[model samples]
Target chain A: MATELIKTRKLAVGYGPRGKVLQGIDFTIERGDFLGVMGPNGSGKTTLLKTLLGLLKPLSGTIETHAGGGGRPLFGYVPQRESLDTHYPLTALEVALMGRFGRIGMLRGPKKADYQLAHACLKQTGMDARANKPYRALSGGQKQRVLIARALASEPEILLLDEPTNGMDVSSEKAIMELLSELQKEKQTTVVFVTHLLHTIERYAHRVALITSDGSLIVGEKSKMLAPDVMARAYKEK
Target chain B: MIELIQVPFMRHILLAGVFVAAGLAPLSVYVVLRRIVFVGAAVAEVASAAVALAVLFQLAPFPIALALTVTSFLALSRLADSQRLPLESLIGMLYAGGAAASVLLITKAPRGEANILNILFGNILTVPATLLWAMAGVFGALLVFQYVAAKELLISAYDPDMGRTLGIPVRAWNMIFYGAMGVAVAIAIRAVGALLTFTMLVAPGASALCLTGRLNRAFLVALALGVVSAVGGVMLSYQFDLPTGSTIVGLLVVLFAISYGIGQLRSAA
Candidate 1:
């Protein structure tokens, strides 16, 4: 009884005319699904995530998203930590409050309930103690947690994260994965993430999509996708 | 200082300086935080060029300057996502082109050399009453816009991709932000000159961010620094018979240096 949230049919995505990275991609993301996108470097993993987020236009084909209320599905995106500039003097709480910006609408400020939600998200990510701390002063792991808090503060139906545990120690990575796991179970939130770490997919993802260097995609349940021969065939194309 | 303030013309100059500082200071916070300081210089230069063109054509300076600066800012906004060239490179091109155009166009006009000097160094002492009123009106409107849209502007500038995912219409917001900044720069050039306008956009924000290290407090600190530098620079200039625009820029640079040193010490401790 999986509820399909997003479906892509023969979708082609890339930068432009000369930058066709992936083609003939088909996938469906369902509610409460933990989906992992995996590939080698420059294999269109991030591009696919960007395409799903509507940050980039598809080169060809169509993406259809069905939300319960009949409007565009709300998304909470956690970009790579390095993509953000640390020069801003925003506190963690302030950064998290950005999630409420759209809901707060134009020409309006955050209200008391918005602040309460942001604080609650920060606490969920174990960052409540440092809510007032400068984001730049945080360590890599703490910064990642704050970013997760920011995403969660949006209260999105689908959470899309790009390399959430990138550049973290093993323990930090495990802790982040565990936190995400707990959130998925507790909230029944749909999760889609891009990762180069196979173990991350093998452990947490219900389904996995592998993008090869030849611009082909292989997607299936994690049990079949994580098989040694299947993984070897995908990596061999690189 | 009291004696200087008692004079009608001196009071007008002080009022003009305060208006320009108040308008540009809060914007300076965004300019510094977003690291688009060169964009400010480019806009100011383009506005100056427009002024030169208007003078050559016997047209009103402010309208033409506002139109051209706003147009140029909108054009430059397209480069934000360009992969072929960095935005800074394009902005640098605009800066150089504007500077050259101003010089070349001014040379063909009557009293062109004097006009060029005025645009560069500003003739703040002789600012007309009409221009003062315009500055007050425009800057007041800009202040209100900034206050109302502060949260949206901050989120859009800080993480545009995330903003996009949140359905923020980041590009449109950016265009509006740049457009407002263009209006401020255009008015500021008329009040203080191109060079001082650029300095006001960068220095106060940089100094305040360094000192406060908090976004909420940074705007107030930046405004205070801007007003202090403007008033201090004017007084020092009158006392020393120095150039007013240059004096203001110098004071801001000094303030920035002091703030940077203090910020370093605070971080170390």
Candidate 2:
């Protein structure tokens, strides 16, 4: 088993009145481990993922991401495709290269090595040949793959995904999930994935954190968390 | 009529229009894309308020208006950056405040056809030499935005989140763009007047958007359309005995319609 790579203490998630969707949520994942967070909509599962990724701030408590050492954490992120305006003029390759922007800094453009790295990421994600394609022209599956390649370009020590399989047809979803799984198995990068797909939560997640309405995190093993009674309570349907 | 270019006033009118179109057209694209329409109008109202003050105090209207535009931008910059309100809401508030100030200025000024009518509706035919210089200054500001701030501007215009995620400094970019746009408007408002400023700001850019498929292409087409509209509008206005700014705007509307039609057909095909 991989050693602990992330730690959070009593973190709350969400914004405005909806803020604190997930409350007092404490969690951790080891390097090379896959942890899934599952909850009903508005339960703050997605918000918690955003918090961990530094996309959103916790209302209370602290979450420190281990980028490994003093260096900024190099990690991949797969944002929901719908959140992006695919109609933007950038090509898939251009969009993917945006992953390097943090390191590329201002004034200076990306280097050849950066492009090579992006290409390699694309190759790994099976998107190399489609690099020239306009981002909008790509189908939903292709966009997800391109996004995954972009995340990988950062060569992050950890990968954070927000509903990666959503808005995708079953075949596309299956393909993308398989690709991610294959990547994790080979790369040994820590994976923190959020999803509502119960089958995925059951099948692929090594550990699971169940979030209740009002942003409460219930953490445990996947099988333990996936119990119907636990889910019923988490969803508050019982 | 052709020999009138030798006259300084007519020269100022046509030249100021050139400068206004140059800056306003592309700016409108950014405005439309950013979904912040009437930002130019708001800024112009503030400038007009400053002009009214200068007139009341017997100060030079252009210089005073320019100063007020800058002042509003500095204040608005702070307001725009603060998190209490969304940028759009803040700009709207600024708009209302500026209009109130200008209206107060006009109310307090010596009410005359020359003071209110000329300043409010714009004295395009009587535009003076100084307006040309103001146009040059604003055009320089626009160049800075196009080159010095292009990348940041593009990012901020399209996806502010991604811009922030990439650490492009969205706050600074916002301030700079808003400030530059304000400066550009202050320069042109005297020539185009408050009522018709959006015509110059929005028309050429909107027309170009209709004309082109890509961002760069859109901007280039916008520049060309702006120049043509400004020059053509004045001449056509004279030819048809119409208002100068209106004629220009009408021509721009026609171009936009034509381009839209063509783009639609092309898309259909």
Candidate 3:
């Protein structure tokens, strides 16, 4: 039986009490699920992602995240690339080392084992060659790879990415998706990503959750969710 | 310069300068990286206002300044996270308010203008032995905190959302960061005046960041440049009959220009 990592029922997510963006979101994210959240520009896809990660509060429902040993499940979150400031003079290795910071705990530094893991993750993401390079000096695709390496270094059970391929070229986007696909297949890492592109959901996601214009959600298998009638109705493009 | 160091007052000034630079320079790396330079400026301004308030109430300046600066730092940090207003706008309001309050509070104190000038431009020569010792203790603690919490602090500043997801109390860390910044600014303001303290907190970090691509190296280079600027400024001020605070700031600016040039050349190469 598939293990449920996150389950939300009758959830409403938004900025504040009156700022409801999405409502009645009921979904289950199982282990090893490649779930893609799709919607229009203002349809609250990112908001829902934030809600699931517990970064934002849900207006009226409960979000239960189940972990093996109880408590909140460990999440690896990759924020939008543009949201991060590049002015910081951190090397790529240093950026990846941040993933181990929580495990390293407070008032302590990263151990030798931590460095080895960070380096291994970077090498896994094909960013080992650029490990010593300044992060700001990297290309967009390379930076995204480094970010993925950072997330992977956390050894998270669930990986969440917000618009992971927002500004990438077709090849870079494909490469990143392929990498995520490989991780999911090999490690059974639960992956949830937010995107507005229907093609992305069709090509990559095993399951799809669509947010309509009126703040309602439709979630199902990718094959069913991508049906022409459902897509047309969800996007109000009929 | 040797003759100058022979004077007891000169020794006191140099020691005070070294302590202040050593503490503030390393913290400056975070301030610059986090892009909160104005927080340093506004905190220093508020600390000056606190000093003025101390003078008016016949209270000890250090404790009063520390209290006000830390409180103001925490408040500003909280407000900066709010989406209602731009962080820069809020910092500007605090800066203006603090500057106005300092001017108003000083007007009623005896030797008000001189005291105001001293607060604005520091009387390094007049620093007492007690204050020097206090600076050593305070700055020493700050250095140790920075060393131990280096990774946590960096993660908190660089990717707060990621930190939160990882169960790091980012808000609490932010509070600690601002509190440490408050303590540093308060003490440095007492030693070097508000303007010079602000300069020390920004210029060295900016220069070192320009010179080095690595964060650790930047911290070391910033510390070196800070000490050089402080020591050079003090000696030049004594030899040239210049204002010590202004001289330090001027030297730092010159060093920054040199560093920038070197960085640009290296990058071109």
Model 1 lDDT per residue over A1-238, tens place: 3398999999999999689899999889998989999988778999999999999999998999987676568899999999888999989999999989889988999999999999999999999999999998998888889999999998898999999988899899988988899888999989999999888888889899998667878889999998888787668854
Better of 1 and 3 by DockQ: 1
Residue pairs of candidate 2 with colliding backbone atoms: A21-A214, A21-A215, A22-A215, A23-A215, A67-A73, A74-A156, A75-A156
Per-residue lDDT over B39-78 for candidate 2, one digit per residue giving the tens place of the 0 to 100 score: 7667766776777788888888777877778777667666
TM-score of chain B of 2: 0.85
Ranking by TM-score: 1, 3, 2
Report the C-alpha displacement of residue A221, candidate 1, in angstroms: 1.1
Q: lDDT for model 1, on a 0 to 1 scale?
A: 0.88
How are the candidates ranked when ordered by lDDT, highest leading? Answer: 1, 3, 2
Top of the candidates by lDDT? 1
lDDT for A48 in candidate 1 is 95
List ranges where model 3 is wrong by over 4 Å: none
Model 3 lDDT tens row, B1-269: 79878998888888988898999998888888877789777877787788788889988878988899889888876776675787778888889998899889888876656776777778787888888999999999998998888877887888888998888888888889888888888888887888888888999999999998888888899999999998999899999999877898899999999998998999899
Each model's fraction of native contacts: 0.83, 0.12, 0.87
Ranking by DockQ: 1, 3, 2
